[model samples]
Structure formats: structure tokens, C-alpha cells
Target: MTSDLKNRLAQEAQDIGFDACRICRPWDVPLVPDRLEAFVAKKRHGQMGWMAERMNWRGNPAALWPDARSVIMLGESYTPEHDPMEVLKHPGRGGISVYAQNKDYHDLVKKRLKRLARWLIADSGGEVKVFVDTAPVPEKPLGEAAGLGWQGKHTNLVSREMGNWFFLGSVFTTIELPVDTAEVDHCGSCRSCLDACPTDAFPAPYQLDARRCISYLTIEHKGPIDEELRALMGNRIYGCDDCLAACPWNKFAVEARELRYAARDELKAPKLAELATLDDTAFRAFFSGSPIKRIGRDRFVRNVLYAIGNSDRAELRIVAQGLVDDADETVRDAARWAAGRLTE
Candidate 1:
């Protein structure tokens, strides 16, 4: 009966739009606690202090909810249709991460997870809890334990079938379902992801120092960025995809099934000058459903100013000049730096 229920659950997940689904025990990720402690001890998480706050719950899924006997890990692909790196060549424009170019995945993925969880409860009469990226849950490690994918050298889950461009969601249930075998590392000798990092965020294979990660810098960071890292940021205004895009396994990546995951034309390669002009109200409306909106106007513009500084385009100097005396000190600092770089 448990085996039959698990089979139906996987089929239900696929019908509901998940690209892949697998089951694992909540306590399967035994290495997470020590690895997480080491990462926090070294101060690698940067401004993401929430990562350190949860302690036991973040590292151990069983502790998070003692009733959860099984973790149903799901992967939803958001693979970009075009080369995500193409926007970098147009320095006058800003490069937003492929995932942020459309609707926010948290809302989309959570809704799907809820539906799947509801189906599981209806089928087998067990309580369930769902999580996207928002919680302290180690979704990637759980995904790896569930055979969704192995955590690649980039420290992100990579599936031989779906590649690295997928989002992870989990449904924790009280039902004792059959678990799949953990996926083994298939990366072999490939260092493409490590070498492609613009900020050298990886300290070693299967390790990431979020302090130097462009994604953390542009989104999670609030204050003025380090001058050296700012220059290396290039035109990337939101999140960086260098490592994800550099993976050779992307050759096998499947197309995103959801139409909402497709890039919006306006966000594809927005002009830095136009983006720099956005006030708080306009910024909110412009990025209404985008994950970029969570950073707020000041940080977003700060990232834009940094991109403008890296562009080496004299025409955008005035754009930065306009924001030099802005209300936010960080934005003002970014503007001054960008304006000075353009003058140089």
C-alpha cells in the first residue's frame, strides 16, 4: 500500500506540472549540520543572517517536524530559452537573472506544492507541510537525498536529466513512503562552473562562499558594496547565473513547462539609464511580481549604478549623476562611484 501510494504521488506531481519528483526520509541529510556549522563559522553566508538563526531546524529536517516521516522533493524547471549570457555584451543594458525575468518562482512553486500536498493528504490521510525557498529547510540537500539531483560543484542541485536550471520545492508528510536512492556526483573532472564565477564565489568544489557570490551581493546585501567586488559585478543588476550557465550538463536541460517562466520582453535587456530613473513607486510597480522587487528601489538602483560604472559608456554618466544626492546613502554612494568611473 505504501509503494502504491508513493507511485500515485509521483504521478500526481507530474500532472500538476512538477518536472520531477522523488521521496526521501526527513533525516537523510546527515552531513548538513556539520557542513552548515562550518559555513556559518567561517562567516560565508554574508548578509543572510537568517541562515544562521534557525540552527537545528535548518540543518535537520526531522527536528523541523517530528511527524514528517517522508520528504517529497520536487523540481520545477525555469530553463531560459536563450543564452542568458548574451545580455552581458550590451553594457548599456543590465543583466537580470534568467529566473527573475518573469514571475517570481516562490509564489508559483509554493502554489504547486500546496496542490501536491493536498493530493497526498486526500490519498493517504496524512498531515503535510510544504516549503519553497523561503524557509530554513535545506531543500537542495533534501532534493539530493531524494534522488532529484546531486548538489553539483556549484553547490546547486544538478540533475542529469533536468540539468541545473530548476527550482526545488518539498512536501513533508507523516506518511512513511518508500524513499529513492541518493544521487551520486556525476560532475567528474568538470570545473566549468567554478572557473566561470565572476567573483570566484566558490572556495572549493561543492563549497560556496556566499560573501563573494554575486547573487547574494546584489539581492541580500543592503549597504554599500565593496569597491573591488563592485567592479567585478559587470552589468549584472539582480542575480548572477555565470556558474549555472557554465555547467556542461545544461545541454540536457529540459524546456520550462510553465509559460510564466518565460522571459518578459521589457526585462530581457533593460537599458541602465532607464532603470536608473525609477523612483520608489515606479520601481515597485515596474517589478510588481518580480523577485527583484523584494530588494526595494534603493538596492536595485545601487546595483544598476554599479553596472553603469562597469559599462565604460560615457553616455550613462549623467544617469548616475542624477542619483548622487539621493535619499538613500547607499544609492548616493553608488551613484558617486559610478559617475566618477564614467569620468575616468
Candidate 2:
């Protein structure tokens, strides 16, 4: 029976290292199009113009594949062993997001999704497709719809069981399966996530302005950051976790079971001075197999210099000054800003 098969699929997902699994119909996420339209209308996605490019597919999963009847949403936790917020106090060290401190989750999660998808097809004889964070699927909304978690005020999915520290992956299939009940918001009157944003990226409750987010500035953004927001970035050189760290629900989070997600010893609290000294070759080698590699040398260095400017360590001025005459204009601009701040 379909019910027994769903149970097997859930068991397989757990055995494959996913912390949670839930199912829902493709049409469950009906609100995505309008929500996405409003987010894009305000030009809030910053330089990630790709958000505006895939409206049809992202807005409605049913439209992506007309015959697909169910969406299997899986959650994999990567909760850190240490307090992620602790690094912000040490301006001398760079704070990469816990998510980026290990191997790229996209590759790891996608491979797992494909494995589960293959099992579903072999068990049920249905065509299937898999997606991690890279695709145009409205994953957060679909996640909420699948009863895997609810979209918290910070706009990331939060589960009563898994908290806010999980990545979502989806498997779409033509086999119709029983769906799980959607989760409800449990963030009653808690402004912890909103107040935690260093850049005040949230314009209102349950909304975000990606333009001002440190994560966007350091990662997706290709050029120099606005000087106003750069100062707020502090030592966070990659993705910012202020909101996720502030979520009180994370107390119940399960630690990641996958060894691939464990933080590398060298990345725990990298020295900003050491990071600023990386040339293109060194940057690539240092970040190989890590998600930070995608940002490349120039952008990564630009972020490092921004942290250097925010760092009150006067000795770090020389590190910034050395890069002031570098080939990349953006890196030079960031270095000049950092040198000026340190000397001031």
C-alpha cells in the first residue's frame, strides 16, 4: 500500500543521514509566487538577479512537472558544537558561518537526495527529480507545506524537533503519496532572531531585506560593499548566522550526524591577518571542497579587508596596507578602507 511505501521512504531518508523527512503535494505551496513577487518588487534580492529569472518554476512546483504528485522534503541538521555567536566578540579572528565551515552542503545533500530518489523510483516505479538549494524550487514554502518545518520569522525553516539548523532537500515524484500536516508558527512574540541581525536586515517581522544582509554582501555580491554595512559586518567574512544563532528553538537541535559537515580545525576561528595575506592560488587551495571557494579570491579578500576595517587591532593595518595596491580594484578599495580605519 501507498502508506507502507511512504513509511519505508521516510526510514530510507533517515538511514541516508537526513534528520527528518515529510511529504506533501506539489500544489501545497500556493503562496510562493506572490511572496516572491513582493520580495523581487522591492529589489531586495540585491545582486542575486537569478531570483527574478525563474518565476514560473519557483512560484509553483506543480508547474515544473505536471505529473508530479508528491514532494518529499528532507532536513539534515548541522548544528554547531560551539556557540556560533561567540566569534563575533573576537574581532581579531574571521567568523565564517558554521554552514560554510565544512564541505559544501549542496553537493553532499544533492547526492543523498539522488540516492533516496533512486530508491523511491525502484520501489514505486515512478519518474523522479531531485533538488537541493541550487534549484528554482520554492524550498522554504515547500518545506513548510510538507510539515517538515515552518518558515520562521527570519524566513528560514524551523522545526519543533530539529530547530533552525537544518538544510532542506526535495524529491519530486509522479507517485501519489499521503501527505503530512503542515507545521504552525511557534515563534510567539520572540524577537530574538530579528534583533540579532547586525545590519538590521529585517524590515519587519517575518521579512528580510537581502541588500543589507552580511551574508549577501560577502557571498553573492561581486563588488565592493556599501561602507555603512561593511562596518556592521565585524569579523564575519562569509555567511552571517546572527539570526539563526539567536533562535531560541535551537536548544532542541540535534547535532549533525554526517562527518562531512563537521568544521575543519583550521576554519574554526581563522585569523583575519592570515586570511588577508591569501593570494588567488592560496585562496583556492585553502577553500577547496568548502562552500567559500565559490566566492573566489577577490570577493573573499574583499570580505577579509572589511573585517580588517572593523577590527580595532592596529597591528592589522600593515596587512591591509599590503593589499592596497593589489590588482583587483575592489580588493584595493577594501584595503584602503581598512587601512584608513585602523590608522584612525
Candidate 3:
């Protein structure tokens, strides 16, 4: 009876637009606490103090909700139709991560999770809690524990069916369901992801030092980025996708079902100079539904300045020079740095 319910749940999830769904017990990921502790101990999480603050809940999904018996891990594909790396060649443009190029995945994925959770409760008479990226739930680890995919060498989940270009969401329930077998590592002898990092963020295979990661630098970081790392950032003004795009498993990536995940024409190769002119109001309006809006104008322009500094295009110096006296100290700093680099 439980097997039939699980099978039906998977079909329901797929019908609701999730590419994959698998189940595991909330206590399945026993190794997370140790790994998370070690990462925080080394200060590798950088300014994401919340990772340390919510250590216990994040490390133990069972502790997150004691009543939860099974975790339904779901993968939603957002694979890009074009070469994500192609924009890097055009130094005049700012490269936005494929995931952030359109509607926020959090909003889209959470809605799907909620719909599935509601179905589970109706069919099985169990309470359910749904989570997207915002939660402390270790979705990747639980995804692996549930056989959705193995965590690749770059530390992101990679699937034989969907590749590494999918988002993860989870449904935790009080009703116990049969668990799927955990996936084993299939990244043996592959260092593609590690070598692909422009900032050398990976300290070793499977270990990421967020302090040097471009995605962390351009997004979560609040102040001016380090001088050395800024140069390596290239034209990437938002989150970086170097490592994910480098993975060989992406060849089998499933096509994204949601039209909103597709990159907008303007974002695909946005002119860095045009981006730097966005004031607060313009920034908000331009990125109203984009995940990039959360970073605000100052940080967004700061990243643009870093890209301007790296562009080696003399014409962009005027764009950088205009912001050197801006109100935000960090923006002023980035502007001065970009102008100075262009001058040299």
C-alpha cells in the first residue's frame, strides 16, 4: 500500500512539473553535521553567518521537524538552451548566471512544492511541510540520500537523468513512506568542475571555500570584493556558472519545462556600460522579479565595475569614472578601482 502511494506521489509530482521526485527518511543524511561543522570551523562559509547560526537544523533534517517521517526530494530542471559560457568571450557584456536570468526560482519552485505537499496530505492523511532553497533543509544531501542524484565533485547534486542543471525542493511529511536507495558518487577521476573555477574557489575536490567563490562574492558579499579575486571574475556580474557548466554530465540534461526559466534577451549578453547606469529605482524596476533584485543596485553595479575593470576596453572607463563619487562607499571604491585599471 505504501509502495503504491509512493508511486502515485512520484507521478503527481511529475504531473505538477517537477522533473524528478524520490523519497528518503529525514534521518538518512547522518554525515551532514560533521561536514557542516568542519566547513564552518574553517570559516569557509564566509559572510553567510546564517549557515553557522542554523547549524543544528541544517545539519539534521530530522531535528528540523521531529514529526517528519519521509522527505520527498524533487528536482526541477532549468537547463539553458544555449551555451552558458558563450557570453564570457564578449567582454563588453555582463554575464548573468543562467538560473538568475529570468523569474526567481524560489517563487516558482516553492509554489510547485506547496501543491505537491497539499496532494500528499489529501491522499495519505499526513501533515506536510514544503521547502525550497530558503529553508535549512539539506536538500542536496537528502536528494542524494533519496537517490535523486549523487553530489558531484563540485558539491552540487548531479543526476544521470537530469544532469547538474536542476533546482532542488523537498516535501517533509509525518507519514512514513518506503525509502529509495541512496546514490553513490559517479564523479570518479573527473576534475572538470574543480578546474573550471576561475577564482579557484575549490580548495580540493568536493570542498568549496565560499570566500573565493564568484557567486558568493557577487551576491552574498556586502562590501568591496578582494582585489585579486575581482580580476578573475571576468564579465560575470551576477552569480557564476563556470563549475556547473563545466560538468560533463550536462550533456544529458533534461530540457527545462518552465518557460520562465529561459534567459531574457537583454540578460543573455547585457552591456556592462548600460548596467552601470542603473540607479536604485531603475535597478528595482529593471529587476522586479529577478533574483538579482535582492542584491540591490550598489552591489550589482559594484560587480559591473569589477567586470568593467577586467574588460580592458578603454571606452568603459568613462562609465566607471561616473560612479567614482557615488554615495555608496563600496560603489565609489569599485568605481575608482575600475577607472584606475582602465587608466593603466
Candidate 4:
């Protein structure tokens, strides 16, 4: 009966546009706490203070809800129709991460997860809770534990079938669904992801220093970015996908099923000059349903200015000059930095 129910749940997930689904027991990742502690001890998480706060629940899923017997892991593919790295060559344009180029996955994935969890509750007569990157759940470890994929050297899940271009969602349940075997690390001897990093964010194989990571700087960071790292940022105004894009396993990746995830033309390669003109009101309207909206206009413009500094296009310097005395100190700092670089 458990096996039958699991099969039905998987089918329902695929029918609802999820690329893949697998199950695992909540206590599968025994080493999560130690690994998490080591990461925190090294100050590798950077400004993401929330990672340090949710110690018990983030490291141990079983502690989150003792009644939850199994975790249903789901994968949603958003493989880009074009090469994500191509924009870096065009310095005048800002390169937003492939994931943020479309509608926010948090909203899209959460809606699908809730529907799947609701179906499971009705079929197996048990309670369920769904999560889509919002909670402190160790999603990559849980994804590996559920036989979905192993965490690659870059610290993101990679699947032979799904590749690295996917988002993970979880459904914790009271029903004891049959669990799948965990995936073993298949990264073998590839360091393409490490070499691909523009900022060399990986201090060692299988580890990341979030402080040096461009994704962290543009999104999670609040104030001025270090001058040394600013030039390395290079046209990337949002999250970086270098490591994910460099994975060899992506050769086997399948296209995303959801049309909502397809890239919008305006966001694909926005001109840095145009983005610099986005005041708060315009920024809100432009990024209405996008994940980039969460960072707000000040932070977003701060990133655009950083890219403008790195672009080497003297013409764009005037655009940066306009914001030199902006109200937000962070934006003003970035504008000043850009002006200096362009003038030099």
C-alpha cells in the first residue's frame, strides 16, 4: 500500500508540471549539523545571518516535526534556452541570473508543492506541510537523501537526468512513504565549476565561501561591496550562475515544462544605462512578478552601478554620474565608485 501511494504521488507531481519527485526519511542527513557548524565557524555564509539563527531546524529535519515520517522532494527544471554566460562578454548589458530572468520560483514552486501535498493528504489520510526555499530546510542534502541528486562540488544538487538547472521543493508528511536510496557523489574529478567562478568563490572543492560569491553580494548583501570584488563582478547585476552553467552534467538536462519559467525578453540582457534610470516606482513596476523585486530599487541600482563601473564603456559614465548624490547612501557610494572607474 505504501509503495502504491508513493507511485501515485509521483505521478500527480509530474502531472502538475514538476520534473521529478522522490521520497526519503526525515532523519537521513545525520552529518548536516556538523557540516553546518563547520560552515558557520568559518564564517562562510557571509551576511546571510538567518543561516546561523535556525540551527536545530535547518540542520536536523526530524527535529522540525517529529510526526513527519517522510519527505517528498520535488525538482522543477528551468534550463535556459540560451547560454547564460554569453552576456558577460557584452559589458554594456547587465546579466541577471537565469533563475531570476522569469517569474519567481518561490511563488510558482510553492503553489505546485501545496497542490501535491494536498493530494497526498487525501490519498494517504495524513497531515502535510510544503516548503519551497523559504524555510531553513537543508534542501540540497534532503534532495540527495531522497535519490533526486547528489550535491555537486559547487554545493548545488546535480542529477544525471535533471542536471543542475532545476529548483528544489519539499513536502514533509506524516505518512510513511517508501523511501528511495540516497544518491552518491558523482562529481568525480571535475573542477570546471571552480574554474568557472569569476571571483573564485570556492576556497576548496565541495566548499563555498559565500562572502566571495557574486550571488551573495548582489542579493543578500546590504551595503557597499568591497572594492577588490567589485571589478570581478563584471556586468552581473543579479545572482551568478557560473558554477551551475559550467557543470558537464547539464549536457543531459531537459527543458523546463512550465512556460512561466521561460525568460522574458526585457530581462534577458537589459542595458546597464537603462537600468540605472529605474527609480523606486519604475523598478517596482518593471520587476512586479520577478524575484529581483525583493531586493528593492536602492539595492538593485547599487548593483547596476557596480556593473557600470566594470563595463569599461566611458559613455555609460554619465548615467552613473546622475546618481552621484542620490538619497540612498549605498547608491551614492556605488555611483561615486563607478564615476571614478569610468573617469580613470
Candidate 5:
């Protein structure tokens, strides 16, 4: 009967647009606390101080919900139909990562997780709680424990069916559900992901140095971006996915079925020249439902300016030059750097 609940929940989750689902018993992710501690101790998280603030809860998932008997983890895929590398060819345009190109996933994942949790309570006669990325849950490790995927050398979860384009969510329940076998590593000896990085952010397999990661610099780092890493950022205005894109497992990946993840036309590949002109009002309107809004116009323009700096189009100098007198120092410095690159 317990096995039946797990299988039915998995099927229903797929029906509700989740790419995959698996259950695991309430247990500490024994290796994660040590790995996270080591990573933070080495100062790998960069300027994202929040990762340090929730140290205990993040390292130990069981402590977040002590009463929970099981965790039902789900994966929602956002794999694109085309090669992400194609965006690199258009230097004038900015590449936003596939996951961030549409509706903010937290809203979508939470809605689905709640539906699944609701059904579990109705069918199994028990209480349940749901979480997307918000909670201090070690989501990646929990996904691995639930048999959804295994954490690759890059330290992000990858799977046989969905590649690394999926979002993870969990439902914590008081009822004991049968746990699925953990997914095994399929990475073998391939190092395509490590070799593909423009900034060579990975110090070694299974380890990342955020100091060199473009994703961390643009999104996580608040102050000035490192000069060495800034130039290599190219026109990637948001998160970096060079590691995920180079994975061999992605060859078998499928496009997302959930409309929530469908790439937004405006976000798919925004032109840097056009983006530089967005005033605060325009920026707010442009990214109303997108995750990009969190960074605000100043930070968003800061990223856009970096992309403009790498752009070779002489015509774009006019746009970058206009921001030199901007109120924010972050934006002003970025504009100066961008305009200088063009003149030089």
C-alpha cells in the first residue's frame, strides 16, 4: 500500500507537469554538511553572505522539519529546444540562462508542490508541507537522496532523463512513504563541462570557485566585479550554464512541457543596446514576473553594461556613454568601463 502511494504520487506529479518525482525517508544528508562547510570555509560562495547566514539549516535538511517522516522530491524541467551556445555567436545580444527566461519558477513549483501535498493528505490521511527553493533545505542533496538525480562534479544535480535543467521542490509529510533507491553517478570520465567554462571557474572536478564564476559575479556579488572575471563574462548578463550545457547527458534531454517554463520572447535573447535604455519604470514593467527584477535597475544595468563592454559594435558606444552620469556609482562605473572598452 505504501509503494502504491509512492507510484501514484509520481504518476500524478508527472500528470501535473513535473518532469520527475521520487520519495526518500527523513534522514540527514551526511556528506552535504561537510562538503558545504568545506566550500564556505574556502570562501567559495563569494559575496552571497546569505548562504553563510543559514549555515545550520542549509547543511542539515532533517533539522528544518523534524516532524517530517518522508520527503517527496520533484523535478520540473526547463530544457530549451535549441542549443544555448548559439546565443554566444550574437555578441550584440545578451544571453539569459534558460531557467530565468520565463515566469519565476518559485511560483510555479510551489503551486504544483502544494497540489501534490494536498493529494497526499487527502488520499493517505495525513499532514504535509511543501517547499520550493525558499526553505533552508539542501534541495540538491535531497533530490539525490530521493533518486531524482545525482550531484555531478559541478555540485549541481544531474539526471539521466532531465539533464540539469530541472527545478527541485519537496513535500515534507508526517506519513511514512517508501523511499526510492538513490540515483547513481553516470558522469564517468567525461570532463566536457569543466573544459567548457570560459572563466575556468572549477578548480577541480566536483568543486567550484565562485570567484571565477560569471554567474556568481553578476548575480551573487554585490560590489565591483573582479577585472579578470569581468571580461570573460562576454554578453552573458545573467547566470552561466556553460557547465550544464556541455554535459553529454543533455543530448537525451527533452524540452519543458510546463508553459510556465516556456521561454519568454522578450527574455529569450534581449539586445544589450535596447536593454541599456530601460529607465526604472521600463525595467519594472519589462520584468514584472521575472526573477531578473530582484536585482533592480542599477544592478541589472550593471550587468547589461558588462555585456556592452564585450560587444564590438561601435554603434553601441553611444548607449553606454549615456549612463556615465547615472545616479548609482555601480551603474556609473560599469558604464565607464563599457565606454572605455569601445574607445580602446
Candidate 6:
């Protein structure tokens, strides 16, 4: 596709409600190998072995598809109407990650990216493949290379205009499209994200120790959480947002245009006592089509137990005690931990 055709595609994408779009040439992602090595060397990736699996392929976007010429990177905002931080104040309530508040973004983003790729094919007479987080591509770096955003110190892509609440999707095409010059960092002299972490997850500027990260603990960490970090987790039952919320660039973020990202009534601040009782069936039914479903009842209950343990409310003891003999060992461990916290 010519430069004019790619630019038109970007404009058309915006008209279709895509917040940001950029075209990046497939090339060696130089920084990713060191970053992955740093993460693995420190055991920061934790139990997510996939991060350590592929080497050459993880550092080169072209490795995923040698014939591909450009990566069309897209961003969709998922900002909430109300302050997502506000839910953390209510210790009795569970804080679901803002991204997973309503609907699954994977299906939503992939559908739109595919539509754009189809348009690109019709205009350019070429083939394309769509990817939404499922592929091994280094999306944040590609976004930076494509002028969509800079990868912030938090290691997530940040656009001066979109903040960190956006989801990334890409379409790799054989067409040699014009590239958008990369974006530069504007995080100048700001350390709000590093300072705000409850568990001090950021070990250094631009690097995160995922082991200490609450999001990793809640979602990625398979076993019971480290006891020291449990109380610091506050009401966050799924993922933490201290780092993302602290970025000043977030002022440009408008509320999510799609209703799927708008907070649901029951999800905003669900009762810990009520959630603690969810069986495997109830868990599936309640979190159907939601990202939380991927974790299953065992891990979700484990997190609830952590929250219950942090709660000073003696009434939740009954709920925690009931799970002391849960079928999942992780849940049972968390229950014992909760029971100990109340008794203490």
C-alpha cells in the first residue's frame, strides 16, 4: 500500500471508533532480549514460563512472519467513567481490574483489527494477519516504533494522549506500507508510578519486578501469595493499578467509547462475603466471557481469601472458615491465612 492508502486506513480506523493507529515495519526488536533476560534473571516473570520460552522470535517481529512488511498497530481505550482507584478504599469490596470490568477486550479488539486488515487488503490487494496479545510479538515496542505510543517506565505502552488504559492489537501485512516515525518519551522527571506501588514493585526506573507486583500476584502468580504482600493488596481481587493511575499523561484519556468497558453494576464494588461463596459453577456463570474466568474458581477464591484476611470485619470469618477445607490447596492455604489474620 502507498503512504496515502495507509494514512486513509488510519483515518478510517478512527472514524470507526479506534482511538489510535500506526504502521510499523517488521524489524529486529533490539531492546526486548535484554528486557526479557532482565525479567528472567531476576525471576520477575514469576510462573509465566511463556516469557522465557522463545528467544530469537520474541526479539524479532519479523520472526513471527518473515514475509510480513509492516505491522499495523492499534489502540482502544478502556478508561472508566468513575475513578477505578475509589474502589480500593472499600476494603470489604473486591477491586476487579478496570480492563476486565465489563467485557472481554480480546474478541472486541480482534474483530475491529480484522475489519481494518480487510480494508487494507481491498485497497492494497495483499494478505494480512491479525493479532491481539495472543501472538509472541512485542506489541509495546512495535507501538513505539509505529508512532502510536512510547513504552513507559512501567513497561507498558503509553501514548501522551491515551494513557495506559488502552489495549493493543496488530495486523501484519505483506504490503510494504510507509512507516510512522517512532514516538519519544515524555515521562520526564516523573516518578509517580514508582512511588505509588504498595509493594514497591518497581526495582528501578523503567523496570518492574513483577514478583512484587500485585497484578502478577493476583492474576499470574498461581500458588498462594507471599504473606507480606497480601495485606498490601488492599481490595484488589484481580489486578492492581497504582502505577498506571499515577501517570500524568492519563489526563488525556477519555472514558471508553465502548459499553463493554463501562463498569457493570454488580462488578464495581462486589461484596467480599458474597464472592467468597462462589462455587466452580457460580464462578463460571458470574465471570462468563470475562478475563477473570481464565483464573478459575480456585485462584479467584484465593484472592478473595487474601482480601478477607485483610478485612478487620469479624463477620467475614465465617466465609473464610468455610473455605479452609476447599478442594483447591491454594484456596485452603489462603483460607488458613485469612482465619489466622482474624484470630490474631
Q: What do the candidate models score in CA lDDT, each in turn?
A: 0.95, 0.92, 0.95, 0.94, 0.87, 0.87
Candidate 4 global CA lDDT score = 0.94
Q: Where does candidate 6 clash, by residue pair?
A: none
Model 5 earns a TM-score of: 0.97
Residue-level lDDT for 310 in candidate 5: 93
Name the top lDDT candidate: 3
Runs with alpha carbons beyond 4 Å of true place in candidate 1: none
- Candidates' TM-scores? 0.99, 0.99, 0.99, 0.99, 0.97, 0.97
Lowest lDDT sum, 10 consecutive residues, model 2, at 80-89
Per-residue lDDT for 1-344 in model 2, tens only? 99999999999999999999999999998788899999999999988888898878889889888999999999999999888888888999999999999899999999999999989878989899999977789999999998988888899999999889999999999999999999988999999999989999999988999999988888999888889999999999999999999999998899899888888988989999999999889999999999999989999999999999999999999999999999999999999999999988
Model 3 C-alpha lDDT per residue in residues 1-344, reported as the tens digit of each score: 99999999999999999999999999999999999999999999999999999999999999999999999999999999989999999999999999999999999999999999889878879899989988798999999999999988889999999999999999999999999999999998999999999999998998999999999999999998999999999999999999999999999999999999999999999999999999999999999899999999999999999999999999999999999899999999999999999999
For candidate 4, write residues 206-277 as lDDT tens digits: 899999999999999999999999999999999999999999999989999888889999988999999999
Which regions of candidate 6 deviate over 4 angstroms?
Answer: none
Relative to the true structure, candidate 4 reaches a TM of 0.99
In the range 1-344, model 5's lDDT, one tens digit per residue, is 98888889889998888989888865837887888888899999888676788888788877777888999999988898767777888999998888888889999899999888888788888888899988778888888988999989887899999889889999989989888899888999988888998998899998999988888777777867866777999999988888899888887686788877788887778899999999999999999998888888888889999999999878889899999999889999999999999998
Clashing pairs in 1: none
Higher-scoring candidate on TM-score, 4 or 6:
4
Q: Residue 86 in model 2: shift from native, Å?
A: 1.5
